[model samples]
Target: MLQELVLDVRKALESSRPQRQADSSFDRIKSSFACQFSSVNPRAFLPWGFVRHRTSKWIWTNEVTQPGGDAPIGARAFRKDFTPPLGKTPAQADIIMTVDNGLTLYVNGGQVGTGGDFRFAEHFCVALRPCLNVFAVTGLNAGVPLACLPPSKSHTPTAPPPLSFPTPLGAIPLRWTPAIAQGAYGVAPWGQITIPSTTPVLSLTAANWIWTSEVVNGNAPAGARYFRRTYYPPTGQTVTSATVIIVADDAYSLTVNGVPVGSGTDFHIAQTYTVNLAPAPYVVFAVVATNGGTVNNPAGLLVAVEIMSQCNCISGAYFISDGSWKFNTGTSVGFELPGFDDSKWPAAVIEGP
Candidate 1:
């Protein structure tokens, strides 16, 4: 029994090696770069926003249900403090951000970027110290109604209401595109909004990843569809960590190299899947998405995958959703296989405003 127990312990420890190695590799990269390769806009690649209100939930730029502070209707301040890996000082660092009305950003008590016209969002880069740091943002919710009409002779106009229309400002699209296929909504059951579906992927880097599908129009088919994309890791570099963000209308499951890593059932919020994978020459990514319910129910899939290597290849070479992805609504047995031919599969269609 003691021998068996020892063997079990060894097996458990061996099972953890991949994760530990990845973690160690990531640390080494950080140490080598001295925090120079750190992402400026860590949240830029996500499908959502930063400010989470008790009233408005995760949806971005919606009406604030619970305004805070003495000036309930004025600007709100947000701050996040982080400690960069200790190393050499960075001569220059950058940040990209935007807010509804306007904002003034600060890094370690130094002003980085200030508010803009609210029509355009910009990226900001700055210098940084390699130790503990403070990153702060003051979001301005300008009181003026977004699309308010001026008072007319026929009717009296009170204060205009806040902007209700979804604006592309402040929020960055990891990649913004409409659904590829247009088909009838399916009868897939709407699962309850579980806790996992509501919570945001905390460490996810928002790079404005684009959404893709097989169809070209806004209308998507009712039934489920299969999609696949392939990625070849950079040579001579070890993959340290990988994460994916998926938001589907009805439901979906994502698998890497035949191993299921993440899935989403609720259509409410984006779900994040993270895993430490062993380095490989190539990785196969597949997804099975279903758009259910009545015809009126819209269908789409937005995905973003982040793969970090020992070489720090975060943005480049990583597979992001785009027209380049080959997708098919029909089962083509062996589609998930890396060597399978997809020349006949339709290219992902991009239909969006």
Candidate 2:
């Protein structure tokens, strides 16, 4: 009878031990689940319900400055001002803005739109005036103060495509050809060269040209300067194409007989300007140039004009740049007109032999 009682006691202890083990295992599983779900870091894995589809391309600012713990939790204000191009109608203009967590956008002191939540980026399109536009954004950090967690390997994004591509268009234009249509899907082969259909009308070396400026030789003044030269066309010469290759230290705007033709902002590369000139007694070429404002940067303008004259007699007669050019320190009203007076302007000094 004693032996039987000992066996019963042993069975009771074994049963209670398993129950205690199960309770301990249950606690461990619960703790793991909570740890996986509780993350405040942006790079950490968020629940499927928290993920959202982006509406547009993300345009991050060049300077990213995330706030520290001591910073405010929400409602930080940022303002930027921009001037739209002149003569752009309201129908042709729109503005878009976004921030890290949430923001409210404003244009010209008027509230355009607002967005909240970190999942979706903020985007807005509004008619803009041609004048100075004031843009303001208020961003909020919607992060929960919790322990940071690691992103799960299963939720990592797949590898991106080799070619650059944007979001697909809802409707393709009707004018798209088969090759062009395939390009929209980012299927174009890498390093493919696109040959331009139009041929260059005129190409000439700068051997017959002179780099010149109105200011002291080799020192470019820090403001816009005007340059002008008159061309007298030979009568009965039918000019088919007229092209000018120009390069400046900072920027230049070209005009032919009071009509703007082209402008260039790049200083490293030369720009080409082409215009069809009707048969006229005279053609006035004017360029408004500005120094780049960087000290020790070479400041000069080089130009080469090429005109296709049907008559061989006038081939090289009027299409050349020389010491006949004059320049002034500032812009003048109606400076591009053929009859505009440049008598007071100083003769341009040759920059190079």
Candidate 3:
């Protein structure tokens, strides 16, 4: 019996060693990128009266009018080459051009675009490089006084507001502690873990893009219950109108405030799923899974989950200032019930009104 007990201890130690190694590797992978660029604005030129105007046909030696009677009609034309950052060329980019009254774009000094009756603001973009490169622009209009011009202005000039550019695009790292526990029944049921910080474990370096999280098993004991992590709607956010996304590995069952929302058997692999909840101050998110059930490996289950929100702004632009805006608008925390594993203990406690 003593020899048997020693064998069991050795086995437990051997199993725990791998878990510790996995946890360390997970930490290194998740901490790879330092979160920055939460304060850069890519649309800095918008408010500065920068706009793009396409033209039907190029008009040379044409007179141009000034906005708000700022300048008289004259033969004025200018051109410049915009080289994107080295080794950082985006597939597409927005162009902003401003003209007193009218403007036209030319590729290598050739008439290729045109615009007329300039007033408030005008902007547009054309495909770049690999498609068609080399470009120039010219302004054209009949010199007219702001007063002489009709009450309706085709173009309006405004000063650019304080600008903040977005961070460059790249992958972000994520890491978390796994749930574990010991009990008289041999092992306790595992509970899901949620990232504690209100902010995302990863930050967005670019706008209008997608990212993925890789799930890894960590410190799972034999007979340990299977578990997964999920995202809940931010706390303090109105539930009536809030949209939450939950993702997982293998299979997952989810609920919001105890209300059944979704369940799936195919998610054993890494995947992102979406959930919408009524706007509310706080929303509860939970997930349950089976160990050694569907996934090929039974050693222990490690799942990484990522939550993303889409914006309607142009490329490289987030409607909000930074990723933190979303977190600030909503509250986030983890919830758990008594289970088989001590590591399964809840990482967060939710306080209610």
lDDT of 2 by residue, 33-119 (tens): 343333221222112121121122222221223211122244433334333223221221122222334555444445544443232
| lDDT for 150 (candidate 3) | 8
| Model 2 worst lDDT window (10 residues) | 1-10
- Report lDDT (Cα) of residue 74, candidate 1: 48
Find the 10 residues in a row with the least total lDDT in model 1. Answer: 1-10
Model 1 per-residue lDDT tens digits across residues 124-233: 33444443344544455455321100110010112331231111111213232211111111111111111111122332232222233534355665777777776654
Error of 3 at 230 (Å): 9.1
Query: lDDT tens string, model 3, 1-353?
Result: 00000000000111111122225756634322221211222222212212212211112221123212233344233333333322222222333332335555443223433333232122223333311123333344355421111011121113221111111112111221111111111111111112112233422211111111112342222222322222232211122321233332334455545565566555334333344544443334444432334343422112222332222122110011111111111112333222212243333211110
Clashes of each: 28, 0, 54
How close is every model to the real structure, measured as TM-score? Answer: 0.39, 0.39, 0.24
Segments of candidate 2 deviating more than 4 angstroms: 1-204, 207-217, 294-297, 310-320
Higher-ranked by TM-score: 2 or 3? 2
Candidate 3 stretches with Cα past 4 Å from truth are 1-250, 266-271, 293-353
**What are the Cα lDDT values of the candidates?**
0.43, 0.43, 0.26
